[model samples]
Target: MTRFLARRTAMLVATMLVASFAIYGALYVSPGSPLSALTGNRPLPPEAKAQLEARYHLNEPFLVRYWHWLVSALHGDLGESIPLHENVSTLIGQRVGVTAGLVLLTSVIIVIAGVGLGILGALGKGLVDNGVLLASTVSAALPSFAAAVVLQFVVAVKLGWLPALGTGHGFADSLRHLLLPALALAATSVALVTRVTRAAVREETGREHVQTAVSRGLPWPSVVRRHVLRNAAIPITTVVGITIASLIALSAVVETAFGLNGLGAYLVQAAQNKDVAVVQGISLVLVLAFVLTNMLVDIAYAVLDPRLTLGGRAA
Candidate 1:
């Protein structure tokens, strides 16, 4: 277990280094430098531009810029936002909690309801199965933005059950306003988890162990509990981890549609404004989220089956 954890830690560090460096390269490769944009359209004189360049280290080599950004990043400083004229880290921090909450709540809903539906669908190959399959297919086919819009119209506008604008308050109020957006982000994820779980569980039930349990008259439910569901959870856990990672960026449309001021929405805004610092900051956050989610999935493998290793070392 210790060896496994060490390997995973090494892999995680390598992934972060690669992701951050790539983001640094992209930011530099873009045309019309951030410094130029930060300056006004009045066309500052050569001397003035030079002063600005020297002050901001715009004249530094690409390597210098990369190293500077990386060092600052290590200290939790993501630099300043050109458009907002504020610390990018500060701006991102303001929205991180909201986004994290939305992501977590959405994940919970997807696992519990979606996986439950999937298990039910898999247990019987009749109308319930067909219905669940159809629903999953439709949800999967729909683009995330379209799903948000449709939900906005039917649930938010038509029924008026959910608020179109987000509310900041106690947990109850926040959840009430977050319902629509969370549902939109979760719809496709739920479908994927449900479909995958159902198939995995059904397949597990047909295995030799499950058949033997049935032959021993261990009661159908007991057989499912011991031999089928237990094995099925492994795959379902994997899918859920992926779902959580995807959810980090998937909430953008829902955030915009519902006016929930979250990281996804902030990222879109930064992109539109061409605020590279803010955009990269948000991107780094998402990458971190992806990495953490994967680590959690790895840990869960050990939780669900002790036979699994922590870092994929010898069990």
Candidate 2:
């Protein structure tokens, strides 16, 4: 376990480094000059331009500037947003909670609805199983943005059940505001989890050991808990982790449609305004989150099935 964790930690550090470099390098490769964002695309005097260039290290090589930025970022200074003129870290800190809340709520919905429906489909007969299949199929075909628009119109605009815009103040209000967006974000993910879970559970039930246990007249629930779900946990866990990680990226569309103030919405605005610092900071944060979630999933693999080592080898 110690060796596995050490290896994973080392890989995490290396992945972060590469992500940071790619994010920062995007500024140089992307259309438009970084100075244009600072100057608002207006012409500047030669002397002023030189001063600005020196201040931002525009005169330095890419590697030198990246090194400087990396060093400062290591100290939690992500530099200032070119458009907003506020600290990048400060902006991200302020908005991150909304996105986190949306993702968390969506994850809960996915796990419960997805896994429950999957179990029902695997165990049920005739109409019940058919209904689960139809629901999952339809959900899998719906995109987050389309779901967002429909929910925003029906649930918020017309029905007036939930607030249509903004991240409401306080915990209770925040959850209420985020609920619709979370549902939209989770639509496809729930379908994915359901399908994977159904497949895994069905496959496990067909195993000779599972059949033997069932034939021995053990309680059905006990048989399922011990023999079916336990063996099916790995694939289900993998899909859930992937779905949750993807929510960070998909949150942008839902946030925009619902007019929520979150990192995803902020990222969109920053990208539009060519705010490279804000974009880089947000990208790095999201990348870190994705890698960390995958790491947790790997750890879960070992926990769920003791026969599997932390190194991912079957013992």
Candidate 3:
């Protein structure tokens, strides 16, 4: 376990370093000059241009600038947003809660609806199973942006069930405001989870032990609980973790569509305005979240099946 964790931790660090470097270098490699963003493509006096470049260490070697940024980031300093002129860390801190809340709400909906529907489909026959398949297929085909528009128009704009814009004040209001966005964001993920769960559960049900349990007259529910679902958990968990990790990136589209003031929305705006610091900071944070979530999923594998070792070998 120790060795496995150490290896995973090392990989996580290396992945983050690589991701951060890529994010930082992206602007340099892009079509326009980094200075063009600062100057809005307008030529500045030599002294002014030199000062701006110096301020951002654009005059330094890429490696030196990256090292400085990386070192400061390690100490929780993510630099200042070039356009917004605010500290990147502070800006992210301010908006992270909204995105977190949206993702949390979406995750809840995904787990409950996805897993329940999957179980039903796996255990049911004929129409029930077909219905689940239909639903999953339809959802899988629906993109987030399309879902967002439909939900906004039908649920928020037309039906008046929820507010269409902004992260509302307070817990109850926030949930109300976030519901549509969450649903939209979760639609495809829920479909993915449902399909994966159904497949995994069905596969588990066909295993020798499960068949033996069924032949021995164990209760269907008992067999499902103790054998099928338990055995199916690892794959279900992997899908769920991937879905959850992806929410950070996917939230940008949903948040923009819904006009919510979250990190995703902020990231879009920063990208539009060419705020390199904010873009790099938020991208790194998203990558970190993805890595950490996958790590947790790996840990969950060990918990879900004790016979499996942390190194992914059978004990």
Best by TM-score: 2
lDDT of 3 by residue, 1-315 (tens): 776678789889999999999998886676665667667899899999889889878899988999999999999999997777789999999999999999999999999999999999998999999999999999999999999999999999899999999888899999999999999999999899999999999999999999899999999999999999989998999899989999989999999999999999888898888788888999999999899998988878777877667446622
Question: How many clashes does the backbone of model 2 have?
Answer: 0
Cα lDDT tens digits, model 2, 1-315, are 777678778888999999898888877789987778778889999999999888767799989989989999999999987666799999999999999999999999999999999988988889998999999999999899999888889999899999878888899999999999999999999999999999999899899999899889999899999999988988899899999998998899999989998999889989988888899999988999999998898778778877677345722
RMSD of 3: 1.8
Candidate structures ordered by TM-score, highest first:
2, 3, 1
Candidate 2 — worst ten consecutive residues by lDDT sum? 306-315
**Which 10 consecutive positions of candidate 3 have the poorest summed lDDT?**
306-315
Whole-model lDDT values for every prediction: 0.85, 0.89, 0.90
lDDT (10s digit) by residue, model 1, range 134-241: 999988887778888898899888999877787569999898888778888888888899899999998998899898898998989998888899999999998999
Each model's TM-score?
Answer: 0.94, 0.96, 0.95
Backbone collisions counted per model: 1, 0, 0
Q: How much lDDT does candidate 1 score? A: 0.85
